[model samples]
Target chain A: MIKVKKEFILKYGVPSLAVIIVAIQLCLVHFQDLSRWKGGGFGMYTEIHYFYNQIHVSGMSVDSLIKDDPSMRSTLGYLMLMPNDKNIKKAAELVLKTTHKDSVYLQIWKPIVNSENGLYKKVLANEIHLKKSEL
Target chain B: MNYWSAIEIKLKDQIALASQLLLFMLGSYVFILAEEHKLWKILVLFFGLIAWLFFRNKTKHPIIWIVFFVLLTIDLFYSYFWVANHHFMLVFMVLSVILFSYHKQSDILLKNIQLLLVIVLLASVMQKITSKQFMSGDFYYHAINLGGLFKFFFTIFPESLEIAKSNSESLTTLKELNPNLTEHIVLKDVFPNLSFVSRVFAWLTVIFEFLVAVAILWKPKKIGTHIIFIILLFGILFTRLETGFVSLLAISGLYLCKNIKLKLLYVLIILGCITLIITKFGYH
Candidate 1:
């Protein structure tokens, strides 16, 4: 071997290095655990919830709210009372982070604007949390 | 002309190169492809619902949203709260329902979809960036409401369901099984009401997303970023908890992973993986 070293290894001698590199990735993925690799910090599951929950916590259900209809679901009150699940909290948190005070404004309008009845001006109607002053 | 042209070309190349470097370093498109079918369903139902809304006036036209919305709600609860899988089945269901319903109003459906998708993606990014979080703070509450991943685990691996139609021996196994096992617990359940975990998770998600965006916008140097990208894009792939793998591929194709060649390849690979994901996980 010393008398006739292979030209293949001489020209493409990175086999050992390649093996080391691949082994490193495999070992790291398996053991080193760098970059939080698969951990949940900004993981896939977290983002999935972000979008899925968007429909529920938004001012009204898409079917009813997009067209400004109030009959199908509550604008704010009942939905607010609806169990705030982990998904809702995530959607709300996204809304809060993205909109800041705008979230509060829109969140308030959820009930006010949702009433099918002319309850926006009414003192006591289906949705009770609204005050004229707030409006 | 010679020197200036060369310099201009080099500058353009460098800007493209810099963008590539930025996107490459970022973990672009985390959950974008992991729960593809489910994401597709979410995308489909999202658009179908819009289409359904466009024809909501038809009254005669029917949308069995009860089933779809139930799935959507379930997925939302799981992804945000519990662990979600098989979201792609929902995707197919939505697509199949709306496949041939193309009509005059379909253009309106398309326009609304285009506009809303932009808003959703931007809102998603904005939530990630401004708050120094990956997603949003509301995530924890959503997770709790859905009972987090544990609920899904129970749904899939129920003690009662495991027994055969009439296996008396199954009853003994049920008694031996401890429903109170914390090993099956998700992080949300572990830290039940802790708001900070969501906040922390949100911030981390944003940072990772920004990194991914950087990778998406990257320009290919010699070998290009695909090799690096596969390694990097997986910031979302390995977790595989929320969205289907295809959603991640689609998002990466549309935005974050800008190198077209790599993006296309990523989409194809994830699409191929769809069936495997579906049968193994069951649709959320």
Candidate 2:
């Protein structure tokens, strides 16, 4: 008779199962591109706050940004607000990239981007204190 | 021992001493998760609490499993992907504890907790390594920049927001060419030397995360291991408050400690964690 030690199950079986489950879930989410799926556009508070900040910092009026690429006005707010949710951030980035490709607007407002494997996510705010010497 | 004999041996420790503590921890977690709900979640926690107090170590009771199963069912219905992943594992482990009737499988139960700690820590290491921004340090850089700790400092001084706003403006202009820039831009005046320091902190976090994962697998018997756990726990406590669930895993490490003195110390650490959790939650 084959003897199965309790230690074997605890040490290997359960943990392995957990890892496998997470891996599968992550894969499904990424391949489905669920992060980029359009949701209800940003609420008013998000719109006004981000637009004002952009205008203040870059000297690019919100009117110009909207006129050049209307999609950007809807997506920029999410880049600033939803930094932690990787999928939502990715979706927001996808919208911005599509709308402002090769434009100076793209240069002036870049969301912090992080990629793992094939998945990419963006965050607001970049490192401001690093010197050329450090890089 | 044969398979059957192993099962028989596992049944010997009929009472799991920490079952009450586990119930309290998991119950409180569920209550917090479902705090905004009407009555279903609250009633479940209330019943679970009553059962826990009345039957602390009576792990063999069928009613206990039923209550837990009901909780699990409700949790599944409400489980969204955004709910931190650890909470799912907590629910699973809690159910397993109830089902195994730690009264009958105390040793196995302890092993379950240990396995949980190892898996969580190891997966975290993998996530960091796989994340390109984490390796390049940009992820950490921005995370810290936008994190609660950074905002908390500004909250107290309020005067510093001007410097922060000015620094942020300049930083945005520097990234016009590349949205995914990993390198940092030097601040003009206030905290002039901090960008590199932030980068170093970022790398340190990854290293610390990797080390803690290894410590759990190494069994954390030595004082050095305990210190690593402490540094990581308190470090997150201040930097990234959201990951505070790790405190429970540290408490779970007590199961692996060889000596009574160390176990007592682990208990005290758990108390400290509970107090911190209360403070954060209450304030929120």
* Candidate 1 C-alpha lDDT tens digits along A9-87: 3322322332333344334323432111121222233322222211232342344433543332332222232223332
Docking class of 1: incorrect
How well does chain B match by TM-score in each candidate? Answer: 0.33, 0.69
**TM-scores for every candidate against the unseen true structure:** 0.30, 0.60
**lDDT for each candidate structure:** 0.35, 0.49
True contacts kept of each: 0.02, 0.12
Candidate 2, residue B80: how far the Cα is off, in Å: 2.8
- Per-prediction DockQ: 0.02, 0.10
Question: RMSD to the native, candidate 2?
Answer: 12.3
The runs of at least 3 residues in candidate 2 whose Cα sits more than 4 Å from the true structure, single-residue gaps closed, are A2-7, A10-13, A28-30, A33-110, A113-135, B1-19, B36-59, B62-73, B99-103, B150-162, B165-190, B242-244, B281-284
For model 1, what TM-score does chain A reach?
0.23
Query: What would the per-residue lDDT of candidate 1 be over residues B108-223, giving only the tens digit for each residue?
Result: 32222222222223334543453211244554333332344334443554452232212224222322333222112112222333355556655665665544444434442222
